[model samples]
Target: MSLRDTFRRDQVFAPLRPGTRPVRPGQLDTGGKHILYMEDITVSFDGFKALNDLTLYIKPGELRCIIGPNGAGKSTLMDVITGKTRPDTGSCFFGQTMDLTRMTETEIATAGIGRKFQKPTVFPEHTALENLELAMAGPKGTWQALLQPVTGQQYDWMAQTLETVGLLAQKDQLAGALSHGQKQWLEIAMVLMQKPRLLLVDEPIAGMTRQEVERTAELLQSLAGEHSVMVVEHDMEFIRSIANTVTVLHQGSVLAEGKMQDVQNDPKVIEVYLGETG
Candidate 1:
């Protein structure tokens, strides 16, 4: 048989490994409280502390915002959570059972944590639907995935996910042809295909138009009760629009954390970040 024919047969006949499946929220052991915990986490580089004895907790289904000036270790914090960087000291946990520090990046993602960076990384040449298909939770290689047909159930779920992100109407549109904001939403939809329990978004509104910003805000708000949404943003106004609780980072530690109004009014926050922004 030819290589293409072999792959086509394998698509239907190959047995999937149990371990390759993405972990569902129902499978997580969070003890009905915090979905994530970072205790006394610290990371250092060349005598510089990127993160210094920081502790944070994220409750299940909560929308939390993180704010800070440049070099405040915001990226490093996400890095640690995503398993890109291993902290020199401290513990990071997903739910009550999973130790984040002990997991690999791929392992963490498969375990239900998804991250969307500032730049949209969709497949520009593919339609939005195709992008999600490629991102579906499975162990297939890209080529194998393209050759495999999506099951009816998977297609229905993908459509629902597109609707959730407000991109169902644009499912057939090429990712490269979509607006910047649409592309961002498309990337989010792609992540949703993995059914993550915790979503870490970085600078979601960086280049969005005002209307796109509003829509994005609404989408994020709608997602909170179902998935724990953690946003890291520099736009204070945007933060105020969606944040119920905001955490401020300075010098690689949590400088302040509370309601948006209170955090904004904090003298320490003003002295370090808000004053500079103003």
Candidate 2:
């Protein structure tokens, strides 16, 4: 059966696993609104401003698409969210009380924020199942985690995750032998293993075949209702296929945002980005 067929038959998308560690007072409190809040964010390099007073908000379980031309601060915006680049000014919060600017990258990830870069990164020497095993979030170090045997429950969860990503059939295959698209799916599966509340995916379909791109769109769409997903992509067609709300970035700030059609029709968006790419 096809991936879409399987998804329809099983409805097998797993619920996001909650953080295993103890929660601090107000750690994830969002006042029942947005899961992410970035207000007046600014970042600069040398003399050039990579991000300037950019404000964005992501509600719980939202799938938001970000599109822009080169040097529009798409990458820098992601860097700020993942704690890779500290902004010169702004208040970034995960939920309501978790101050992202005050946290480390590791801390941010552990707090249920996961990022998947453009390139697929997987353990080539290991089987698909083994890669997920290594990626399972826990207090154990890498070597220590590898040493411990997979429990029956853990194994079942891993199997389910593979199925969710349409990779159950390739579970025993070496990751290196998988196709490029499959490798991308494997990396996504690895991130899913961490059970993040918000997922950041950068250019997910960059080198994918048409068929692969379709599958990727379906995969990302299916993930939305349970985990907030932010996708930064250049392909207008792919974005149109998956986007409900699109945000266009220009010169380090949001130029336009709304339904895809509205954003497409925006005069500013056309002048800055769509005219060239659309």
Superposed Cα deviation of residue 53, candidate 1 (Å): 0.2
User: What are the runs in model 2 whose C-alpha is more than 4 Å off?
Assistant: 1-26
Q: Report the C-alpha lDDT of model 1 over 1-278, residue by residue, as the tens digit.
A: 74323322123232321112245642666653478878789999998999999988788999999999999999999999999999999878787567788889999999899999999999999899999999999788877887898899999999999999999999999999999999999999989888899999999988899999999999999999899999999998899999999999999999998899999999999999999998
- Residue-pair clashes per prediction, in order, are 0, 0
Give the residue spans of candidate 1 off by over 4 A: 1-27
The per-residue C-alpha lDDT of model 1 at residue 11 equals 32
Instruction: Find the number of clashing residue pairs for candidate 2.
Output: 0
What local lDDT score does residue 119 receive in model 1, on the 0 to 100 scale? Answer: 98
- Overall lDDT per candidate, in order of appearance: 0.88, 0.87
TM-score of each: 0.90, 0.90
Error of 2 at 254 (Å): 0.7
